[model samples]
Every structure is written in C-alpha cells, then in structure tokens.
Target: MNNIVVKEDVNLPALPNTVLPAISELTAALGIPRDALASHEEIEYAWRDLPRELREIPSELRGELIARMCVAVSVGLFDGAMNYIWNAAILQLRQKIRNFSLAVVAQIQQNDFEEKHLRDLQDSRLLGLCLKLNIIDEDGFFFLDQCREVRNNFSAAHPTMGTVNDREFTTFLNRCVRYALADSSSPKGVEISAFISAIKGARFIDNQRQIWVQRLTSTHDAQRQLLVNMAHAVYCDSATAEPARLNAIDLCNGLSTAFTSSIKADLINTHCEYIAKGLEEKHTASLQFFERLGLLGLLDESEQHVIFSRAINRLWDVHNGMNNFHNEPPFAERLLELSHQGAVPETIQDSFVQTIVCCRIGNGYGVSNAAVCYYDELIKGFSPREVTDLILAAKDRTSNLGRRIAGVGSCKRNFKTVLNLIDTASVPNLVRADYDNFVR
Candidate 1:
C-alpha cells in the first residue's frame, strides 16, 4: 500500500452542490463512529478526491471523471445514498467520454483510500483498505502486516517511557476510534488523540516534545490539554533507567520554561498523577527553576524519602555492586542512581518488571537504555580502546529516545553523576575507564 500518493491532474470538475448531510451519513456507514469536528467541507477537502473542478480541466477532462469517481466512492463507502450518488456519478463520467483515461481510472481506483490509517505515521490506509477490499489477504497476519511499521516505530522507544502511558494513550486512542466508528461525537478529541498516538510513533525523538511546545504556543486549550496528557503519559510509562530519568528531567525542564514558582509545581501536581513520581527524582531538570524561586524548600522531609526510597529499590542490584555487578554493571549503576535518587520501597517489583521489557520481539533500538546495557555486555569482549571507539561510534548513532543525552542543565547534572560514579569504589573499575575515555 502506497502511504504516499500524489494526485496529478490538469482539469477541474464542475463543482457539485456541496452535500454535507450525505457526507456525514456516508461517514457513519463507513464504520467511523465519531469525529470531533468533521463536517462536509472538511470531508471534501481531506478526501483527496478530485474536487468538482477547483480548477478547469484542459482537453483531458480528467477533473470531471475524478469528481464523479469521488462521489461514487463516497456513495460506495456510505452504501444506500453512496450507491445512488456513485451510480449517477459513474453515468456522468461515462457521458464525459473524453475523460475516460485508463490511467486516471486506475489512479482513482487505487486511491479509494482517502481515509487510510489517518494516524499519519506510515500511510497505511492502503494496507488496511486492501485487506478490507479483498485485494490483499485479510488473513490472520494482515493486521499484523498492516501495522508492522507502526509496531516497529513504537518499539523503538525506550521501555522506561514504558508502554504504560502508551497503553493508556492507546486506550484513549481506541476510545477515539470508537467515536470515529460509532459515537457520532465531535471529531476534535479524535483528531487530537490520533495526532498524539501518531506522533508517538514518529521517527523523531522530540516529536512529543514538539507537540507539547506547539500546544503551549498555540492558544487552543484543548490542544494544550491533549499535549499535556501526552507529556504526562511519556513520563508515566517509561521503564528504562535513562529515558525515564530524562522524561522526569524534561517535565521539569518544560515546566521551568513555561511556568513559575508554586504555580509550576501546582500545575504539574494538579494535572499529572505522576507528579509525585517525578518529584521523587529530587534531581529534576528545573532544579534551578525551583531553587531560584525558593520553591525547592517546599519539598518536605517525607517527600524526599519516598522519592529516594523508590530509586533505592531500582538500585537494589547495586548493593552488591563490586564483583558480580559487572554482569549488568550499567543496570547496577542505573539502579544505584535511581536508588540514591530515592523512591518508595520495592514492594511492587513484579509489576515494574514488565515496564522494562521490549514491546516487540527482537526489536533493537540502539540509543535506548536497553541498547546501553547491550553495549556494556558486548564491550566486555573488546579491548579498552575498542570499547572506547565503540562508545564514540554510538555517540553519533541513535536518537535520544525521548530525552536528550545531554541538556544544558541536565548535562551538568550528568557530569556530577559521572564524577560521583567514577569516585564511588562500588562501581566497576571499567566504568571510570569508560568515562575518562568518553570525555577525551
């Protein structure tokens, strides 16, 4: 299925009377339950069908044919009225004999997929529609095949931004899908959630961040709320040590950039259920933002304990950090950091374990915390120089996994951690060796 289809036309169809009710009825028939704000105009605009001659066609007359075909496909998807309009449109197209180009017909037939995946990640409507049309096998594997790219794309995220919020995002997404199919509600929510879900599946590391930035910059409150949920979800779901750490960092960084004083913390606390979880880090991205404002002192003694306690549990493997820690030294180091940072106890370790697992089988994301662990083990088999070279090589590879490897404030924090880790006798001797080499 071509995710990318560009229409090349030289003519326009005489504009048909804009029939909005017919469009909505047809959308209903197509199994779309709801749309936040989809209307006749939007339908016509987004359909990718040749409009009733937005421009005049030359001798080719392709515009008239495509316009007719658009009505026909709409009728077909919508059924009763769709059948009527489609039959009439086909007749009209036939009457316009000069327009019966085989190439144009083929293109129209292929493009019967105007409302494809709509997720905007990989133009997968072709795959989904082909499966539905019986042009392609709709066997057990079809859904699997259709979303292979999407799955692959999502799998690339680090587990620390575990699929938790992604799962919730998916749930909300499914709710929107239900609305698109059966709810007959506004298209607004559906569009927003779809945007978030698709953005989560995008190739860029900072796509979600950009969305939040856009939400903040835009005057639209709904878009702002949608992005807020998404940002929170990223923080709430992550499983890997580093990405999760950075998500927590980014939330604070983002908050600092946007809000001030207790208002910032108030906003985070008000909307984010995971705010307590995030603050547990103690080492937040906006420590300066809070510190300079004196909001830092608002954190009480117990709050600090819970945060550090949870980190300690994630760091449990680190207590035995000397010899066997080398088996998963990075894990131990990360755990140690998390532990030292503080969190509640390790009472829910089983539930937390799944958050760290890879979403799909054999999915390898190099910039992921998982990849860091994988590399740590792989480097054990190499010479120190080779390991140093590999680390340098990786520096140029893989995106930030939803968090920059270094940020202005976060970099200084990481530097502090590196210094501490290097000085700490409990860590592997090779850790300091790697750090010294990394800076050089």
Candidate 2:
C-alpha cells in the first residue's frame, strides 16, 4: 500500500552511526526482506535522506511506514519515542528488551520516579521491554489483564454493542485508564485486532489505520501474509500465563464477580470486517489455546464459570468481538468440529444457551439481551435457504421449559439461524477475500 515513513523531530533518542549500520548488517546475515544492514556510509544516507522523505509523505503511506517501523523497532533496528508511534503489543518475541530499556533510559535521560505521567510511560516501555525478552512479568501482565477486563465492562456503559469506528480506539483506552483506576472487580479485558492495529498505526497520521486498511484491501499486490497474521492474532488470548489453575481461577473469580456490570461499543463496519477475517481464521491452536490453558490448571473455577458465562452470555460478543461474521466458510466448519468433539468445554454452556436464546426467539439467556452477533456470524456462513432449515432445527430442539442445548445439532442449527436472520450490512464481506499474512 505504499506505506509512507514518518520522521519525528521530537527530542527523542537517535541511534549512533554504529547502531544504524548494524541494522543492515544483521538483516544481511538473516536475509530479512527489504533489509540491508546500514554501513557507516549507508547510515549517513538513510538518517539524512530518509528523515526528509518521512516528513513530507502523504497519509496513505504513513500506515505502511508505521507498520514497518514497528517491525524495525522490535528487531532492534529503530529505537524509542520517535516523532511517530505505533500500536503497542504484549506479544513477547524479542530477547534483549531489558537490555534495550537500559539503553533507552540512558539515551532519553528520562527521570521521574513520582510523576504519574512519566511513570505510566516508563511502565509501558518496560512492559514492551519485558515482552522483547519474553520475560513475562506475571504481576505486570495480570495488571494489564485487570485493566482490560475492568474496561470491557464499560461496554455496557456504551449505547451500543462492539465498538464504533467513531472515536477510533481513544474510547477504549480512556475507559481502560478509568477502569484501572476505579478498581472494578471485572477481570482485565482482552484486545481485539483493533487494539493492536491502533497501537501499530496511532501516530503520524490523522486518519490513522483506516486509510491503511483500505489500501491493503484494495491492492492486488498486498502481502497476503499480513492479512492472514492479522486474522490469526485477532481473538488470540491477551492473557499472561498463570502458574496453575489457582492463578487462573483467581483471575476468573476476580473478573466473574462483576458480570452484570457493563455496556457495549457501537459496531462499525471496518472493525467488524477485520474481526471477521481474524475469527474466521482463528486456528485450532487459538481455541485450544484457551482450553489447554483452562485444563492446565492455569484457569480457575471462577474463571471457568466466567468463561462459560461469557460463552453463554456473550456468544454474540464472541462472534462479533472476533469478527466472525466476515469470517470464511472454514470458520463455520471449525465451529462444527469444536462442537462435535467432547473437548468443547462444559464451561461454555451458559454462553451457548445464551446464543440459542438470541437466535431462536430473539429473547432471554438470563443476559437480558442475547449477544446477537455470535448468532449472526455462525448463521452467516450459510445461505438463506440453508438458514431457514437451521431455524426449524433450532425451534424443534428448544426445551419444554425453553433452554437451548449446546450440541452439534444446536450449534449447526443456531449457526444456520444466525445467518438467516443477518441483514446484508451485517456481513462484512460480500465475496470474501483471503486474509493476508504478515511477518508477525
């Protein structure tokens, strides 16, 4: 998409010529794409010439450049608070972040032990550093987890479901800050792709990643790998590994204690679209990721219940949040597989019942309103004709007292029902496109 680079004139740290040259050298050794370790002479040219180009670039190119920079920084090529910024991540892939942070502290000469602003910034930086080294600080990650869960409850605080493209991600962050500070019992929230995407494209452009998403989708030359990676990571867990079930239970109970305490974000098309592709491609590893974590004793009883409740209470949120509506056919097939296997957690039953309620008669799941999104996405995979048959299947299976069962029949029927009811706008892609993969 012709991603433009941004050159920040901020009084941020600059890499030494030796450091800059090392980028090309390492890249040459590893044979990374578009990489060449800068020579001392090459560093001069890049630092001098690259900065000028970055300054004058148009908005469209900014997203591409910003994304590239994120990769660069992670690899130890680029460093620190550039005039530009990116979406932050908890994905730990680097091994020298601790070392990098030490370097950063010295380079920036940032000092302020008591100021909240600086503390937050440094904490964020430290988090990034820890991730690089794969040194996952359990306490700190839990802290982040707390922030997410607490903040997600604020969705009820919103007037709609899922997020709207309106405020972009500012609403999510602002609320997270408040939730974290207010001390809600809700567990920390998990991030959707938008969260990471926002961090990736936040700085350097006014339109943010909106323009970038468009460019990538519009291109015949777009890297399919990036799209695929984006989809794969979308609903992936944002939690830190807990020691055993006890810790997980603590987290679950901690978050569960606050179930009737939230709101929704307005659902937007772009957000939904990205979410769909990701959820569609969410591999067996991802779903199993949670289940395995649960069985590992890394998840607690409370957490199990909460997870179930969420599954029951927010199946729609599960689908919508994960952007399942735009997902490909394989996603539906995968859902069917998960449902058929005895491996599907009993914990998710409560939520599955909720899904039946939402899609069956448009009513109760003890959750007030059903998370309709889930019902919709699963059903969307089917055609209108198939949907009607599914609806019949759902209606036939309703309990005498009227609770929906969580079985292959129910799942398949519900999937059909959801699709049948979905309006055209609800589906993000008319003719689906392959989610592109990237070097995550």
Candidate 3:
C-alpha cells in the first residue's frame, strides 16, 4: 500500500522563499489580490497530508496519472491534482466493468453494449451501470457519485465554482481510493447469454452441474437471485424441452441452500403472479418447483392444503391398487418429504392422519413393508391436533379404520403398533382417556 517510492540519498527540492513574494507582486501589478492563489501555509498543510492519504491506495494503482497527481499537489495546484486522481479512479471503474464482460452487460440491458458505449458513458451513468452489475455496492455508489460531482464542479475538469482547500482535497482523494481504486474483491458478473444457453441446452452431467453451481454461488447475490427467477420461469414454460426443464430444476436444487431472503421473496411474488393471472399450467409447474426445492412451507396455508391433499389422495389410491406393496413406497416417501418441509395444514390434518393410520394398519393380507418406515415417521411427527384426529378415527365404528380395528386379528395388533408410535404427551386432554383405553 506504499504510495510514493523514492530512492535513498536523493535530495528533494523545497519551494523557494522568494516564490510567494514574486506571485504577490505579479498579482498586484495585474490589479488582482494575491488571495486568488492558495497561501504558502495552506499548501504546506495540504502537502503534509499527501503521504498519509496516498498510502491508502494500492501500490499497483500508483500509475502515471497518480504520479502526475503527486506532482500537481507538490506544486500547490490542488484543482489539477483532483482532476488526475478522478481520472485514475474513472479508468479503474471502467476496467472493472470491462472485466465483468461487456457482452454480459449487453445481455442484461437487452441492447448492444460495446467498448465505445462504455468509454462514451457519462460519469453519472457509468456509476449507475456499475451499481446495476454489482461491480460497486450501494454505499460505494453514493460516495463515488459525490466524488464525481466534486470533479465536475470544483476540479480542473470543468470551470470552477470554487477552489478546494487542503482538507477538501484530501477528503475527495480518500473517497476515490476507498470506494473504487482500492476495492479489489467486488462480486464478478455472470454472462447471462452463456448461463441461459447452458440451462436450455442438453441435460447436464454431474461435473457440469457442479461447475454451474459453483459459478452461481460465486456470483453476486443480485445475479444469483435473478437466475433463480429465470430458472422457475424456464421450469414452468410448457414449450421448454424435457432435458432443459430437468436442467433448470437441477440448478435450483443445487443452489436452494444459498437462497437469500430477497431470492425467497422474488419466488413467492412470482408464484402469486401465476395464480392471480390464471396461468394454470405455469401454476402447476410452480408448485412442483417449490416442492422440489423443499420450499412448500413458503406457500400459503390454502396452497399447502392443496399440495398435501393431492399427495394424500395419490398415496391412498396407490395403497388400494393391485401390487400395492410395490407401488406405495415412492408416493409414501414423497409425502414424507413434503411433511418434513412444514406442518400439515389444519384443513387437511384429518385426511392426512386417517390415510397414514389406515395405510399403516394395512388390509387382511398385511402392510406394504417398503412403506412402513415412511408411515411410521409420519405418525411419530403428528401434532396434538392430528393426534386427536387419530384417536377419533379409532373410535368411529362406521369408519373403515374402526371397523378393521374392531375385528379380532392382525388389524387389531397393527392398530396397537400405531398407538405405540404416538408420544403419550401428544394426546390431547379430550382424547387422553380414549387413547389410554385404546392402548390397553
């Protein structure tokens, strides 16, 4: 972070004593006061602070423009020093944008972006682009915008509104160095065109998938959030090819753990839009999107009810079909995953408890051995309200479960096993007596 490098034993010249008087005499001859130029004391104060301020800038950034800035400061031309430092900072910002990929900038803007466009960009607009691309953050943008204003109005770049004193000059230089020149770890921009193409192309293999996931994880949160929205859109598009759809879901699955609150908010907003606009196909796919990401809990209660009820009905249907033992595990496992995401909604708790209890109780033949673990897990996680539903199902003689339990065989024994899965503390007061009697 050293600013100025000087060789050992090299003598540096100081300002001559007669220089100030000569300037004063010339100003008197021109009929203008000597106050137009900075006093010797003001220049001395400014020079004293130069080494300290310049040390904040990185060694690699102390290029030709910086050297010129140093020379200007030594000569007491504070306005010219401001101009040189501002130019160096601007060049660094432009290089950051260029390194971020001008082609990607074009994709995001949805227009042609070239070197000329970058070079010709007004200072204000360049900061705007840098903010949008996440090359600089919000705080950086604010401070740098202030610096740009100073350069335009007070520095040598434009006609002077006022002259800057030593403190003002140091403050401007500090901001430029802190915000743009010394910041080397800003988030890199992703190339939108390449990202979209890779997602829409053939399905990704394991290594390729890992590579893309690493890229998304490495990028700025704004771009990662934008890509998540795009992935949802792609997954929901009916026209998208099967492989592409798979790719989209895979990308989402990989990055699900890294989703920020902003990303989650964007997803919820998009899902709500689909429902409001009556985009049934997209809405259906959107549900699957949430389900695959294990984000079903983020949906409203009514939507969660629909998701659970549909899953429960599908499991029940598979349970009653021919080869029920072989067909039930997958559906049961899926239901287990959904339940893990959040509680079963109050609206669907009755059917959810009954189906799981009934399936676990089994028919006269026996239970689906493969699905027993899933049913056991679901029963073990029942809320107190759901526990009440379970006890009620056992007490209702007209119901299939009660009818089977009342019989004198394996169904009765299986019902006892179901009761064992429930914790004694979970039994509601109204059902405590019935649950104890049933266990006995």
Candidate 4:
C-alpha cells in the first residue's frame, strides 16, 4: 500500500482588498487549502474577452462604473464586480430619472437629499425606486432582484460560502449591463391625466376596474405621478363630494397596491420624506396627504416606523438649538396620532417611551411647557407600566439634565404634573412617595 499527501499553497498576501472578513474567517475556519489568489495581470487577461458594455451609460456614471468593474475584474473579485454591475444599472436609471425631474435633481445636487433622505441605499431599494418611478419595467426589476439575491448570498459584503465560476460570473455581468442600460418607455404626461380623469368618475365595476388596472399596470413611471397628484386632489379638494373622493382614493390605492411589496414600501417611504419636506416648507396640505395615506392603510408598519422616527427626531431638530419648540408639539402630537392609529408597533411602545425620556432637556433650557405637553401626548400611546418605567428611569439617571427633567427640587412641580397624567394606582409607592415628598 502506498500513501500520498498533497499540500495546497496559501497565498496570504495576494487576497483582494474587497474580500470580506467573513469570507477570510470562514476560509480559515474550514482549514481548506487555498489556491494562489489571482493577480491583477492574470485577472485582466481573464476578462480580456469580455466586451465593453458600458457605452450606453452616461459619461459621468460610465467612467466611475467602468473603473470599479475594471478593478473588481483585475482583482478576480467576482462578487464585487457583480455588485458594481447591478449598481451601474441602478445608477443609470436614477440619472435618467434625475434628468426627467430637473428640480428634484437640483435639490439632490444642492445636498437637500442628505437632510431629507438616507443616502446609502441598498440595491433592492434603488431598483425598487426605479420601479416606482417607471424607470424600469417589472420584469427588469424582478430580474435585478434575483441578481441582488446572488450578491447577498455570494458577495464579499456578506458571509457566504457560495462560489461563482468564470462562466456564471460573465453571464450575469452581461445580463446586468443589458438590464441597466436598456431604455424605458415612460408614458406621456397627457396620457396619465386622461387616464386619471377617466377613472375618477367611472364606477369601479368589474369590467371598468379591470380595464383601468390593466392600463395602470402598463402605464410608464413618469405618468404614474399623475395618479399620485389625483389622489392628493381627492383628499385635499374640499369641493369633492365625500363619496366621490373616497372612490377616487380607493381606486388610486388599488392601483398602487398592485405593485410588489418592495416597490410598494419604496413608494411609501419616498412619499413620506416628500410629504415631510413639504410640511417643513409650510405646506399644511402635506399633513392631509399623510392622513389620507393612513386612511387608506397604504402605510405598512415599516413605513409608519420611518414616518414616526423621522417626525419625532425632527422635534428635537426644530427645537433643540434654536429654542424653537413650536414644531415639537405638532410633531409629538403627530407621533401620538400615528400610534393611536396603530401605526407604531406594540413592541416599540417601550422604546418610544425610552426615546422621550432620553431627550436631553438641558439644564439652562429646562423642560419647556411644550416638552411637557409633548410627552403628555406621547405617553398616552404607552401602557401604564411602560410609562412608569420611563418615569423611574428618568429619576434614576445621575446627570443634571436628567435630574432637571425628572423635576428634582425646583422642578418638582413639573414631575408632579407628569405623574398626575398617569394612573398613580398602578405606579409603585416609591415613585408616588418621591413625587409627594418633593412637593411637600
């Protein structure tokens, strides 16, 4: 009998910079013999036969994506390359949409997107946004979603043991480039208005409704804004008959709900910021926009969570440094209204209470009457137990700001008022005693 042992070479220093720790950690854990990591020259030679598919992309984005893809290919980083491939498509779509809406593009260009939106978006979300805007067809969106799944399961960004060979990688790379660079057929604005007007008064009977749905499903993204515009009118137009308005709202929701969940969530999330910014600019109608959305249940839990979180944080932003607590009450009230509408989840009720308590009511500013009123409204959303925990937690904190807001000594009157708002019967005697002792 003869025995042969073969040792595999491990090229420690040749690994690509894009390789995630999870991948390297897993490789080490498995004790698998590593092949010599491909060098830049080797990778470039391998990709030499791959055609330049970025010609259709805009110049600004084309150069950046080409650079990213070249580096990824040069490093033999299949996952990063795929990631960049999908990103290139989304970038082109967003750029096209920006061109379509110059004003929005200007706002983004002026850095308003930073204040109003979360900049680092995931590929699913970016593709979903494109879908909502009619920049990509449903087939394209779903196919890209599949590509995103591949990235998530095999890319350097996550911990995955999956591997991609040259054939599979090149095939997907070309497919992504095609999908991203393909031209979308946006419906003319006139077409969208006619469709909205035709559907607004028509009874949504099976035949009529089905025709409208089919047309809506086929309508391009640029034209879909008219549907939103019409829906906004239905809610905001006081002259609209009650029954007619509700019919129009229902019709609009039916069309929107037809989209996949990711697309639907994207539409809702984007609209939320748009509406909030509108409100900031003193567009009171934006509140009605949100109320109408709430009435239709178009806002899912996650969308509502984003709305609530943003609105609450804005309270501090609007008031914190400027002493402009005027907006705090309204936002706080809006947060409560959403909670009462079952928008905020029960699991998050305690966290909301914690957020309220965690607010740094500086000693110099003290707790404003608006702050007191804000929490008075906010605490109504929580259970007696949760509210009690919040009060107790506030009292236990050792900081001057905490002690000040907790109503220690000179602030006892404020603390007593907060306690009175809750049912003291459920509160521990110690909490009641502290309030009583401070008052006496």
Best by lDDT: 3
User: Per-residue CA lDDT of candidate 4, range 134-197, in tens?
Assistant: 6667887877788788878876668866767666677677667666763433322224445556
Computed on alpha carbons, the lDDT of every model, listed in order, comes to: 0.35, 0.35, 0.88, 0.56
Q: Is candidate 1 or candidate 2 better by TM-score?
A: 1
Look at candidate 1 and tell me the lDDT of residue 35.
53
Query: Pairing residues by index, what is the TM-score of model 2?
Result: 0.20
Query: What are the per-residue Cα lDDT tens digits for candidate 1 across 135-207?
Result: 2344512433523333333322212222212222233223212211111111111234444454444343576
Q: In candidate 3, what are the lDDT values of residues 107-153, reduced to their tens digit?
A: 77889999999999999999998988778889999999999999999
> What CA root-mean-square deviation does each model show from the true structure?
24.9, 24.9, 4.6, 20.9
Least well predicted 10-residue stretch by lDDT in candidate 4? 5-14
lDDT of 1: 0.35
Better of 2 and 3 by TM-score: 3
Ranking by TM-score: 3, 4, 1, 2
Q: How many steric overlaps are in each model, in order?
A: 45, 57, 0, 1
Which residue ranges in model 3 land beyond 4 Å of their true spot?
A: 1-56, 185-187
Poorest lDDT segment (10 consecutive residues) of candidate 2: 431-440
Whichever of 1 and 4 has more TM-score, that candidate is: 4
Candidate 1 vs 4: which has more lDDT? 4
| Per-residue lDDT of model 2, residues 1-440, tens digit only | 86554444422246554665556666777878433322344334334433433343233334543455433433333222121222222211121232223333232233422224323454356444343223344554555554334333323222333322213223333332222212211111112243345433324243533443443333211122233233323333344222322222232222232222120011122223434577433333343444432331233344344434434434354443444434322333334333432332454543443454344333222221233443344444444333333333334546421234333444334444344455544333422221010000
Error of 3 at 400 (Å): 3.3
